[model samples]
Target: MNTAINVQGGQYWKSDNAKTWALAIAQLVSWGSAYYSFSLLVVPMEQTMGWSRTSTNAALSVGLLVSGLAAYPVGTLIDRGHGRLVMAGGSILATAMLVLWSQAQDLRMLFVVWAGLGVSMAATLYDPVFAVVTRDFPTSFRTKITLITLVAGFASTVFIPLTQGLVSWFGWRGALIALAACNVLICLPIHLSAIKRDAAESRTEEHKTRIKVEARESTRRALRTPTFWALAVCFTAYYATFAALTFHLVPLMVERKVSAGLILVTMAVIGPAQVAARALWFAVGRGVRPAVVGMVVTIAFPVSVVVLLCAGTSPYLLILFALVYGGANGMMTILRGTIVQDVMWTKGYGAVSGLLSMPSNIAKGIAPISAAAIWAIQRDYMPVEAIVLAVSLMSASAFIVAMRFARSHPGEVRERIANVGANNS
Candidate 1:
């Protein structure tokens, strides 16, 4: 029980718990507003624009590609203590882009607007948020991270039905306009109220106002180790596989002739189960090694993929896949951020994570479209499963390699944690 609340400019900065909840609130607001809203718009947009599913989906793909391009750059900006600025800009852009999307007349126009929204997603979404939390709260970033992701997991469940209702009453265009308004009116204000520009600078100055052994080691030596690259490889595969599978999940189900209603029900189980699994991880993960946690989540990829590939349309297997895959994927999001911090502190997070994330984001951007292309070529789901399986195997292998590297690296992770302590102290 640690309770030392310090007031800075009339705001509380002392309690890690408070900061955790605040950041988590921000994550929920940002991700829920952006990512969750996409699925809802997909169906209605297809219906209204009289567009083919591929074209409608192409707009989203374009958005994701823009987002992927934006992730690392946004991460670099966040590292510069301009996270609040980036997030605010993202919210504003997202709000404006939603309005633009409402008025799109053709696929080209829709793709163009979504391309803008992609940039917004990069700035406001999890990558930036992950960078923010890791920088500001060093020691407890993991548990807080887990909590934030757990909350954001509910975005689909909460937003999907709400969006459907809104589109029902107001029509898709009107609903999109209303959603744009909410992004501006709700999300924009929250960011402005909660985040202040000087916060990052003040922390940076405080940490660097003096130098110590840990600081010297973090700055001078950590980069030379193999651990960092190993960790990066692990995370890249994690994101690539997870992103690919998630984007293709629904279509994969339909290809298997799984009924839409059952798919919905099974998919619905994921959010709550994700929360529960994360909570469990938070409680027990502290007792285990970071490598262990990473491996558990990483192996879960193959488990879920294998189940889906082998089990056909069985509801039980699908539900099982949802729980294991969703829980592990949700847990892994936090795991990636924390593992970096656990192994390296906040010193090189932006650059290292950003570099590692670039390729993965590209993979994510291409995953759905690539999966679709594969499906088209094969005229079935078998080839798509092959791709997912290969990706999963690569991820699992990376995790195994990372674990071995961590064990051999000895004091690498502890040294990074010590660097954070030396700064705050």
Candidate 2:
């Protein structure tokens, strides 16, 4: 790893630790204010606006869809060294959208506000941030990515209660306004002050030239490979199951005759479980291969679903399921951030990762409605659970296949470059 400091502009952070911490703070605020706050506001919006639950929720769905659609373009911009502008601009847009949401008097206004929020989500969320980190700390981005997620993982834990308290104190509209203020006051400054264009531009000219050339080849190679598609299938399937189960878990437990108290307990366990799993990995598993980690967590997903399937009203089994599922889901975020770099070369990482994430994000947006449709037909959670389990298994299988391919054919750009040099010689 090159330790020499290459300063492109006077604007970059002097310390990598400072840069990582800044991005981490920005991520926490972004996720908390933009993403997690929606769930808390949904019921309030429905009641206050007199819109049906489905209509209110559809606005969120549209936001998610727009986020998915915007990801590739956002990533392309990041790759072109617009990380600071993208994130800071995103925070500003999100702040405006939140204020818009607070004042929305009709369903049309609600949809329009959320649609803009979706574009902000694409710019401010994990994917674009990951691209920035990968570009900035090319040598040790995995560690930085882990650190960012470790801090950002608390977004839901922090914001859910905070948003609830604000709503209780000042109604939902007031809460939205306060959340908007958080974006403006907290997130915007951190993003603008922390991220510098020189972070990506500071690389040596030779390195930049190499990256440009390899980026094109690596992207072309990746799109042509089975491994890429396999990984995409794995993540898409996993996210679909994850989304469906997440939206339906409480109802599923209720249908199983579990007491409300036990259901809440089970739900509460997930956040801690995720944090614990990530902490454990950071503390002890830093040396472990990401593919190995991927394989284990992918398998854990199915095992967790199976535990829930067989628990049959048993609180102990339900708790067990939550722990396993939550831990896997938590670690999966880290895996998703690092796995592409681990399995393949890092040229064009942002573009490739954006491509990989598009399908999964779309799947996530679709899964809830798809699960609801299944429930509408079956009128029970049994079939839904089974479908989730099946998808989980398929995801695990696809990941295993991708792992094998990665092992067999690693470093596509490196090998291609070596071969071209040899032929010229």
Candidate 3:
């Protein structure tokens, strides 16, 4: 029961659990509103503007590219106690960008809006959010991070349907405008109000004290380490395949003759299962090695694909595939954050994970377009599924390799902590 940090006061650390959950709720709503609205609006946009899906999807790619590139610097900024400001500003900017997007009449304007959305993402998304939690609640960060992601998982389900409703009621432009207003009205106020920091921060002093004792390593030096590349490859390969699978899931289900309603319902399973899996993982996580948990999750990628491939004619198989695939996808989201924290201390974490993740996030941003292009060329999902399965297998291999290296790597965790301490100092 350590007291919360108060630089000027003697008050003990009180777990800002309420504030954390509030932040999580705001995160869920904001991300849901921003991301989930796209799919629902895409068709309407295409119909009105006579734009191809490819053209519309390209805007998303641009935004994601920007978001990926901005991840590292944003992480660094968050570590430096700028998270609240970044989150607030980003929320406001996102609202403004959405307003602009609602008014966009051309692809060029849409691209501009999404690009700004990318900057907004850099400012507001999980990296910055996770940075705050990780720095402040190192011991309990696993569960907290898992919970935040779990809650946010519902964003797609909540906002996607809401977007559809808005479009149905008010048309796409109005829906976009309404969503933008939501960003301002709902998200902005919550973020601004809940994310207050003390002027005299004790974590700053803690970080400084910790950093001075740790060895300094350049990013290059860090990258040269086997664990670095291993993790990068692992995340990249998994996410690339995962992204493709998600983008193509509905189409794949349709091809399998699953009913649209069933597919939609099944898709909804991912979010709730994500939360449930995190809760389960938290309940039993102490019993297993984290790397092992990661390995199991990675293994699910290929298994789920195999189930889907086998699901061609069987409804039961498809359901199974959904359960496994969706649950794994949901849980892995938490594991991504946990894995980085488990591998190192807060020192250099923001920079390292952010930089390593850039390419992976780029893959995430582009995977949908790439998958579609492949589908067009091949005229079958088998190729895509096969590739994802292969990549998943490789990623699992990389994770196992990385774990071995991590086990043997000396001083990495300590070094990271020391670096954070120094930076804070």
Candidate 4:
């Protein structure tokens, strides 16, 4: 199979750089409108609909859970060369659901809209986009994936303020309608234009047969490995901790008696800090092993949480926490993008990654609501912080274990591929 052929002559953009930029833009819009926009809408929805914050936020949890459930099938589809259709369809659905959510008059309606958005998320969000990059830009996929995250890291920075402005100018409902327009006008076109159609048509039957065998063997091998399960556990716990902190950060700060202005300043630092971290990674950390990066960032999670816990009316400590947390989160995204290729070969990268992401996505979906329940029971953020810190430590430990295991049993798939080539020769 010729990797360069797809880049040179296919339905995708003629240049790899062009395709990368298009997908990066698409990711920014998709994430900004679909996922990050939800948090900004929570207060407005609660105020207008007279629903409790928990009830309103539950809709997002439902959507994320649905997204996690749908991830495997969506990944399988992308593996089958349906990347363009799946992503474009997802954007269209997201647009429709956002419009529906704009007019939601009841909690049930909100749930319905968000439930549909969940499927859209599985199709449009990071997992699907990462799969597309892996499939399309197999040679330079790591750099491309990093570039996408570097841009999309600003999803919250872009949409939080934009959503707030829209709400202030035209109310929450009108703001949602405008977001729907973004999905349709921005995300859908970029996905459709960027993803190449099936490249199997350009390959010989022998090459096609060899690729399929490799993909199947890779998936089978990955499923049977302890490394795969360890990574799953590590990422699941990490995402749960991240989601809980993200959703509850403001409230947690408030409970500590931090003023609203200081809270905003602290929160605003996170986005830029994330972007700066990614830029640094691209400049200096790209040559490092992803497992090394993973272990380092996982440690940062617990340390950042501890800083937040001990901030105690110190704005400097809070800012320091934001920098550490944001930088680690940013680098973690790049690690996730590259780690599968590092630990395993890229034969069935999309499917293998999807399998790994399933539990992680589920954890992300459940973390916020579960953390809220914890806060309700304890009546404070301290216990919640402790819970997150414990999970973060567990996540770090699991990744370290996985890295050691990979070191002892490196290139399992690569060895298999080598043996196959020798037999063929």
Candidate 5:
């Protein structure tokens, strides 16, 4: 109650629409408190604790690494009709981690807290939640997922300033206590009440058996496709670049002599940019295949890096960088959430998304410290920027190849979707 995060989703939220509204509200708190707020905590933690950047970022690395490891099992659990248990449990865990993080002054303890946070992320974030929607509300997932991201996109815009203000008023420790309250008070209640109990979780033995068999078969079909692996390669590279840059963006801007206030303004611009892009997609993207939408955004990834590289010390260029980069990432989340069902079968969606994301999450886990190490080499961010630029190019190339592979392998994908349809019939 000490923190006052604007629950903007309440405007149109209705009790009867708990499926969409509850999950959407929970996502805002979950992402704002557990994920987007991390970078803001970094400077305060560093200044107060006197920890080096690499050492500090390694804690996040630990959390993300643990997230990747936990993703598969979490997905499998959600797919089996345990979405309520998985997400609710994750909120509980996240609350505990945030409280522990507030008290964890020791480096090792910070890591332990973050490791727990990693599990919380796997449970509560987009992938697992998308799996829930995909499995439970199969007919309307794209609409639901897009709406959820549109609402949650404001996490950065809201949280960055809010967290900074909390840090100013209560210090980092007190700010964390307030964030923990958001999880327990806001997100936790929603997960327990919003998500209707899925019938699959309580199906008869025969039905359960049938579900398991179908899930396994769907997973197997996906694994046999070259598109799955190519998409993996694409995301693995893109996420690494994405994580490294976000964690380092402020420092990178400072290195380029961007003023502090301008840096904050630029950061603020990104969240709205993301929201605007998703709004555009929502208005026009439903008819477009997810793969084509993905290809267009994948190109934007390299272009974003190029824009930033060309910006130098120009403030207008920095604003442009934020818009392009944020818009691309916003659409990319949509692609990540829906592409599996579009290209493969919706059966075992949770498991398929988990397996597809594992490698990318691993790369995301390692990137911050890896970029920091490169920064350490020259005590300069030039090499680090160059590396991300190269990886963006690599990511785009891999995604294009993934689309090609998906096109060539259509017969198998059709057969898998057909098999799932027959099961439903």
Candidate 6:
């Protein structure tokens, strides 16, 4: 086994396996506390604070927007041997932000708090973690990535009920405090201890400059590709639908007259279903083509939404929606990490993935507010549901269009991109 100098002055890659699991666990907690817990808190906050749905949702929207803006800079920091700093600092800041969020006394406070939370997300979430893993573990990264996502897929399953139960015991404010404690106690230690970079990557400044220059040119080439834009559209549309549904699902089910117990159960079904589908895909992923998987995953999105729309008051169909929706959403996570590499070259994945994340993160930021606006129009979620269903279809269509451009010619397109970069250089 190849080894590099550790910070301790003596040793090698002793913590690769530990690093993988620690990052996975941190992602699960970070996402669960910062992201999934928002929906459950919405109604409680609205009832207690007398805030409009739009008003409450706007805070998170702003946070997500900030997250989008912070994505690139965070990636750049990770590129500079700061993975431990970024993730550990993100965990600490997330703890502080969650505490502040619990004490939010006004709209301004909520907005400010969530904006900081967004920055934490940019540092700690899947993209940043993936960057650290890819940088630290060049070989066997796909398996590691798959395992990381597979574990973190249970974020919703575990956090949703745990949050609701917290709310039940001590109200929204208390629940957030509990969450903050969990973030600090669980994530902070793991991030600091587990994320160890190989010292050999600390090359001379000239080597670093050359890599950056090449990465910039590669990004430029990707920008000119029709396939990249289609993926941007596909992912943006997918995220819009995803965010809208995630932030609005509980309320939508309530409006449809679903029981509180049933709502929890259905929502809980999502995480396990997500894990199961991901495990299945992980087993058979290499045998299948990415384009085929992409199409199937995209098609699954609208199908799940249609099921939700048609379920009405039926319990069985609602569970069916959870299964399909959760599975699709899980597979989408894997696709999000892989599709960019499949369609584009992986020479500068962090930079390229951050670029794709910009629009998608913005879509996530806006989707909640957009859904709230639609709900406000008729004071109904049916309209919002219709919008979600439409966007899901739009995402599927965008992927189909993207496949048309690069499906038969991924290798050819990659060669062209490399040649263009070489010529430009």
Clashes of each: 0, 0, 11, 0, 0, 0
Query: What are the lDDT scores of the predictions, listed in order?
Result: 0.72, 0.85, 0.77, 0.85, 0.85, 0.84
- Per-candidate TM equals 0.87, 0.92, 0.88, 0.92, 0.91, 0.87
Which of the two candidates, 1 or 4, achieves a greater TM-score against the reference?
4
Residues 139-203 of candidate 4 have per-residue lDDT tens digits of: 67888888999989888888888988998998899999999999999888788777887655535
Q: How do the residues 140-178 of candidate 1 rate in per-residue lDDT, one tens digit apiece?
A: 666677777776666666677777888889988888888
Over the stretch 287-327, how does candidate 2's per-residue lDDT look in tens digits?
99888899899999999999999998888999999999999
Q: What is the per-residue lDDT of model 5 for residues 244-312, given as tens digits with 9 covering 90 to 100?
A: 998899999999998999898888888788899998898998899887898888889888888888998
**Cα lDDT of model 3 by residue, 225-317, tens digit:** 788788889988888898889888999778767888788777777667666676777677745768889988888888988988888756677
Candidate 4 error regions (>4 Å): 1-11, 200-217, 411-413, 416-425
- RMSD to native for every prediction? 4.0, 4.1, 4.0, 3.7, 4.7, 3.9
Model 1 Cα shift for residue 305 (angstroms): 1.3
Looking at model 3, report the run of 10 residues with the lowest lDDT sum.
209-218
| Over 4 Å off, model 5 | 1-16, 47-50, 200-202, 422-425
lDDT of 5 at 188: 81
For model 5, the local distance difference test gives 0.85
Candidate 3: regions farther than 4 A off: 1-15, 196-221, 410-425
Q: Clash pairs of candidate 5?
A: none
Winner of 1 and 5 under lDDT: 5
Winner by TM-score between candidate 6 and candidate 4 = 4
Candidate 6: regions farther than 4 A off:
1-15, 40-53, 164-177, 198-203, 259-261, 413-425
Better of 1 and 3 by lDDT: 3
Tens digit of lDDT per residue, candidate 6, span 255-289? 99999989988977888888998898878885687
